[model samples]
Target: MSSTTSNIKFNRRDFLRTSSLAGGGLLIGFNLFTACKPNAKPPVDLADLNYKDFNAFIKIAKNGAVTIFSPNPEIGQGVKTSMPMIIAEELDVAWDNVYVQQGDLDTENYTRQVAGGSQSIRFGWDALRQTGATAKQMLLNAAAAKWGVDVNELSVSEGIISNKAGETLGYGDVVEEAALLEVPGEVTLKDPKDYKIIGTDRKNVDIDKITTGKPLFGIDYKTEGMVYASVLRPPAFGQELESYDASDAKAVPGVIDVIEIGDKAKKLLAGEKVNWTAQLSPSAKVVVIAENTWAAMEGKKAVKAQWKFASPPESTEFHDKKLTELLDGKEFTTLRKDGDVQKAFAQADKVIERTYESPFLPHNCMEPMNFFAHVTDEKIHLVGPVQTPEDAANTVAELLGRDVADIHLEMTRMGGGFGRRLYGDFVYEAAEIADTLRKPVKMVSSREDDMTTGVYRPAIKYRIKAAIKNGELTGYYLKEAAINGNMYGLIPNFFPAGAVENYQVDVAKYDSNITTGAWRAPYTNFLAYAEQSFFDELAEEMGADKVQLRLDLLEKVKGTTDERIQYSPERMQGVIKKVVEKSGWGKQPEGTYQGFVAYYCHNTHVAEVADVQLENGVPVVKKVTCVVDCGIVVNPLGALNQIEGGIIDGIGHSMYGNYAFKEGMPEAKNYDRYRLIRMKEAPKVETYFMENELSPTGLGEPTLPPAGGAVANAIKAATGKRVYKQPFIQYDEIWKVAEKPVLG
Candidate 1:
């Protein structure tokens, strides 16, 4: 972590040995030509490709093609393009001159390469820059030595170094010499003001390939003699395949073998014993060994399987009901506490209490969970569009009983992840099928399989109470209950650790057959909606402005006075203040309704104002004004895109998206049944960023939480009704209300 810079002195003899003649011009492959130089020394590890477990390699080819290896998976979040922007910015190269290659599974050189939590930019901010800067310094040192000029007087632009005397050399000419010099302990990184490419809207690096329908995803990856495999699981959450007649399945075209994969083998190979008691029922009997995806799919459809549904029909219903019941319980974990809430409520002139409920949601990534594995006697190659590649690699290596070195994982650009790719179950499933078949196999989940197979965002219930007197906020209480679904084991300590006083937050788990995992924004998605909605209600009851009320309450906990509150009040206020100015909060437009909400998460603060108008009883969101303080913006256009997309997606999830269960099975199947916000339904979105000197935070998930609250609050303002549930106000209901126009 220590930064260092040292002056490198290179003599004339060193320069000659590193230069080579190629097509009448000099061609230099740093290490290759170093031996021929006049006073050449042994090749130096100038850029310790092995330094501190570097995630990627930075190489300057003889032609000045600056190649960068990106370790993190890029799933349409623009990391494939934005991350290289950071490198080019520091390397002082033109964006067009840079080429990016996805890194392989190299645990020794790259650790912690999993991509999620919208942390790609933040993680690359330092590492990639340092790498580029170090390489740039080496090249400059070599050029300065060859020109017999001071290194400080030499400037580099677009991979070329020019001196005050007008003598210049392309990076390709000095790359060899630079490669022979000692790697600098520290290199000076460029300031943001000096950046030429970052903050600008650059086209995605893989856009052309994607647009032309090139093979850029896991589904497109194919190998010689590769076979496709599919698994058939029970239809219901707690159902198990008791028996199956695969005789007809084996008769299907291209059927190679039929092997049953059970929980016993999965447990033994995975090193974690199967907890039969914890399972809703016995694991499914998987049939592996196939010719192609279509063949397997067809065979699966023809197979007759007997499944036993052990879990009761009320499994989901019981859990949903339990969440509501917990909201009324007195005993709960205290997240924040200040004055006695009971005493404050007794003294208050008015007490307003309301409860809100949110249903479970599915990630429904564009690319369903899939993995391609080629397993042999010596090594195994796994490729996929996964969020957690490193974790997946390790799990596969361990399950195969092979050294980690024998496993190679290549992460392809995902269609969409949204936290769904964080799970490695699909990776394991593919590896298991490959190992069982002893061949290269790709395990692809059908849309139905992807939806029904466990892991969803847990349903939640919230109870909010606010005590007001003389139009001033005096006290507040919030209680939240949901299934225990923190995949990373972080939620139990999240809310209780900070900002609010007299806040009781408790999570209760009612054992159910269904499994749950992370969705976009996780708990914050529901928490912000509930908290912001309740705040809106409280503001109305107190006859106080919503923004002013929040500001007043925020002033009390502005600074980092408490360790539990991990958000910056100043950053929060900055976004809030910016949105207010940009949206003209106090100005009212005829036939338009406005509502505002702000939240802090993922180390970023976002405030949004939503403008809406009823169109024939349907809520038509006209525009949204969003202000964010994510510290230094990396790519302004990309950041804005993230905000805009998150807003639109959030709107859909809030007003129309819902995943319910009937008889222990999800009712919604696909986009047809599960509604999504289409292009025509999209609202006009305006985004603004706060000016700040702080380091960049995250932008992807921060804007999502406020969209629901902002829209709900706006609805409440237009109509004297409170929406306590998702998809609460239907289009037909709104139309009915609009038809009864008041006659003055």
Candidate 2:
């Protein structure tokens, strides 16, 4: 939980000058203070806003309208609205009085422009509120100076300022003067109890626009002179473009051009200044540009390209033998170590051992990948749904031989990001194609391309061993092996890390040519499924209550003076007991079986009870009672929606089974082959958050990690079977039944 992280400071920047409205109005160009970059520093003196290098534009119209620009990317995580709410709330403005606008990536002015890590709210929770409070204080200062009264004697409500003497001033009346006021070194924040908008149920700023199809997503983005383009990538991971004949592609009716994208094109533009070929790229592929999306698709299909397959030295195959060798290996890099684990296991009355595995899960975001870029001779303007636009812009600059100033990255709403958008390969490819064609280009990816050409979630295997002596847990050891990238690096010691007296966590890894990126909860998404399921098995082994055993471990952690425990044991116990009580843990409906699991991730503690029933051979989740404590919930409705979505997302993956790879290529290329939770299979999810004054954490990812285990344990309760691997739809196979469970 501890490492080198720069102290975050607010730095804001505006992409465009504050465009004035028709009537007399104030275009407030507030400076962004600290950058979002890790090494960025806070101002030496806090009293002045002029010292920082970021910008956020807020406008107040003569008609008393206010628009606050949101500085982070919105990838359907509800950040486009939730972030502005903190500002509006602290400003004491009516919910209806404020307008929300998504802003561009300004690294000098913003930190964490990307939306992964569930940090949209966590990243700027305080600075955003302070922004609103600062505005309010400035407005108050302006009104007081105009009225010849002390600021303390004046008060404001819903953008209206008043004095005891009955003088009144609208926010619009003083916005001009307020803009001139200096940002104070300090400002007073309202008490959590007095918050008018923080906990209130307000619609998303773009709800109406989204529901009516009036608002635009990245895939829906368009320009007057934009051309459509699609890339033809190699079928598998270890293949690159060798040669291609574009004659058939160019012969298509609306085909504009066939662009070859490779080391040659990149080196020609970037020269030796940048490692252009090593940067973000969809793949080394050929681009088919056309007048329409249909033409681009047809033209791409007609383009026949030969590929050079990677030799054994470059290829990675985890599905077969390599995984077994890595998992069964003894040598490892010790990440966390405590008391002697060997002695505890040797002396224990009982020793439990199990291995759990998860396959490479493609993001399979609802919207296929796309980015719109216009790289002309002068400046480069790239915009679309990228989770990390700032990084994308940097990559584009390296590829196009452009300056950061010349490159402008705008984030549009995304249908679903999951974690795929974090890599700007799509954006880079779009920029490359546009730069080559000398025109605006919208790069589109078919579902097949999206699934096939993914930095998929790394396939991981966990070997867990626990020692129990005289019916009491003693020691634990976990060796997690992952193919491809970093695992348990950011979060070490893990959950049971501090829960046990003698504990150790070791990591083993193997090289992979297949790319990998963060999926939902990443490690926790699979680790929790294994660890918590082991606890249930342990509960049965020790003759302890399933829910009581978790509470006991947390209670032990609470009493322990362990310095490594970063999470609060009280918080863990709070959610566990709350879920147990809420879900009627001891009394289940006659025909329904139940499962329990709890986990802490992304700084949120979540406990879930999945109530399920066996329909034929398939396990159907009937209802899920979820209790979460993510500090304070930002938006109850939105948080509930997130919890519901995550639980169902996990259930869908668990029941349908996730991605499978063969010959280093994903077998499930699209939804037809891939599986997702259908609406008919969705269980009713009841969600609740504990009352707390802690700054808001995140919820979108916490529920998902525990969902798979909860369902797996429930399947154990329904049919005394242990399903180790996820997509437990294969459970019936444990009995070697004539018919497998029908997932559909």
Candidate 3:
């Protein structure tokens, strides 16, 4: 497919025409015909399109095919299918005719292209529907004018505009005329009851390509004359490059050049203004212009290098111990204070206090981080597995001291993101290396590099206390100490902060040798684990049902508190009720262990129940029952897939996940050492969505937080001892706790 500049020439006139056609409201015209041919090349200068200003476009061609320019990246969360479902609902089109394309980094048409935070569906719920509604209205108006009838007398079905008088026109027959109409500013979106496709199950748009090994991932991205690149970072955080011997590397076949690209030097001399929000650390050495990825790997292994460790060397153990000590101390900033905790504890019939600890986690996305860039004096073209194109474009422009308009960042389907791709550190590295070598370079990270050098989920420790008097919960206290280094700086308002009255919360931090970034639900990941576990403990002490205990607490705090709670109690209760009914919470099979947990995040509420059994002293998850309330479901199958994936991932982290540091460096370098969940270990997942019409919310990260708590609860049921720490009851260490009785 050839590139076209029609968008530029048809800008203002097209916008006004489409708006006028859509009942005199503002409208945005998108070229839907672009999706007709596969592998269509985007216009060279279309990178200048404003993504933040307008939502992406979905156009229907005359042949009933719908093309969607997806602003958000599809990183195994299924936005490619779900986002298109939103448009299809309002366009009144068949799903078979829908086609999805990766949108260019056009700030004019998209916002928050970053795929983290599970915000894709929540943000696109209204915008994508409006885009489709506007187009559909324009087509109907064109048909009405042709048939000399009122538009209200016409309706659209499967890309056909038909009138009550039996006159009809296909979308293709009126698209040229509709394209000439002014874009409507206010298109009436169809109500949820009228939706034909939004709530329906649909297959993933790229599943066929993925399962067949089509070139849809960054690892498969290739171009002629392109060379591979790699970097050697310090084994430990805060360590700096001292010196390196390149003689052996130069002798390696296909090796081209070894360059010292220090982050400090670039900050000072490259005329690039670094944005710390991007979470990039200083890189001291990078090997570029290699023949292939394998050759680059061999050359890197052969190169001799040395590093200087940071002063006052800090390791993961040091940081973990320090955080534990600090939590034991009395001095900490109080985030919440309600009733007198001292009095409540003194008068309580029972006081339960428990400390929970979780280690740092690596994203370990199926696909490792990689980016390909071709930088020159005139312009830069970048493409790869990136979640945020706008941020990438801005950072690349700043790093190269080029116009943001000249730096183009194209997104590819990511194997997975899980908040890891939010940090564009890898993008900067690729762009800088490409600029220096003046050739196209694909910077690839080995599994080891991706696991160790990349940003990690912060290690956290939580101390929770609850008071119960006469089988009635009175007060609660929670204090959390975690590694507060990296992007998302210390967010003290994460959870349990504004949710409870007569409660106290404190958050503290200790610096660590590990570099950290967002993973899945960010602070919510651990907060859910701690808070939900505390609730379970409280329920046991109060002799109350677990679900009933949560419901009562939610009711007690309703409307009598602040507005910053960040969740809807009704919605939370709805999912809990749904899960309870579906999982048969009160009834149990002989020798089966059951655990339940619920959480709210990313504007979505999720509740999960896990059934487990002990096999050879290892916790084996048998099945997971999940209930999600994300408002209107964009794509039922995609939503279900996300929940299933999240549960599997969360189980892996709770049972087998760990990133250890030895002598200030990561001990688990690759999959061999760092374990992951495989198909043989996969448990049966049953997911249900609560029906609603309040617009869609996020699905990806919201389901993850509950998995850990549910699995932990199930393990506690299976074994009499409560496991507070993650990777709970590892098989190698199960013998140490064997004296503890296994409970039914």
What lDDT is reached at residue 191 by model 3?
61
Q: Write the per-residue lDDT of candidate 3 for residues 1-744, one digit (tens) a residue.
A: 111111212244433324232322223444332211233322211122222323566655555566776777878888878887877777777778778887777765455566666766665555566557767877888878888888889988888778897877887777767766655545676767676887788888888988899999888999989999988878777787888898888788998877766554357335546554366665487564579988888888877888887555666678779888879987677766777777888988888999888888898888998999998888899999887678778877777778998987778899888778877888888888888888899999999889888888888888988777778777678788878732322233334444444577777777665678678877777777767877887788788988898887777555645644667788888999999999998588877899999888777889999999878766788999999999877778887888898888888787778777777678778876766777988899999889877767787878888898998888888786677887664444422434232222
**What local lDDT does model 1 show for residue 175?**
77
For residues 1-744, could you state the per-residue lDDT of candidate 1 as single tens digits? Answer: 223342332333322233333422222111112112244321111111111222545666677777766767887778777877877887888888888888776665565465666666665566566656767887899999998888999999988899999988998888777756765554676767777887788887888999999999998889998888888877777777788888888888887766676553456535553221112224656664577887888787778889887766644577777887777776566544665777878888999988888887888888887889888998888998987676676666666678878888888989888877877777777887788778888888878778877578888887777777677666667667776633323332232234444443444555566777667876687777778888887777887778887887777675545554656666777788889999988697777899899987666788999998878765678889999888778788788888999999888788777778887788767765665677887899999888765667777788998898898888777776767887644332422433222111
> Candidate 2 at residue 294, lDDT?
91
TM-score of each: 0.88, 0.91, 0.89
Name the lDDT of candidate 2.
0.76
- Using lDDT as the measure, which candidate wins? 2
Give the least accurate 10-residue stretch of model 2, judged by summed lDDT. Answer: 43-52
Ranking by TM-score: 2, 3, 1
Which ranges of candidate 3 are over 4 A from the true structure?
A: 1-54, 62-64, 263-273, 346-349, 485-500, 731-744
Ranking by lDDT: 2, 3, 1
lDDT of each: 0.71, 0.76, 0.74
Q: What's the count of clashing pairs in each model shown?
A: 16, 16, 28
> Candidate 1 clash total?
16
Q: Candidate 1: misplaced stretches above 4 Å?
A: 1-54, 263-266, 269-282, 310-315, 335-343, 469-471, 486-501, 729-744
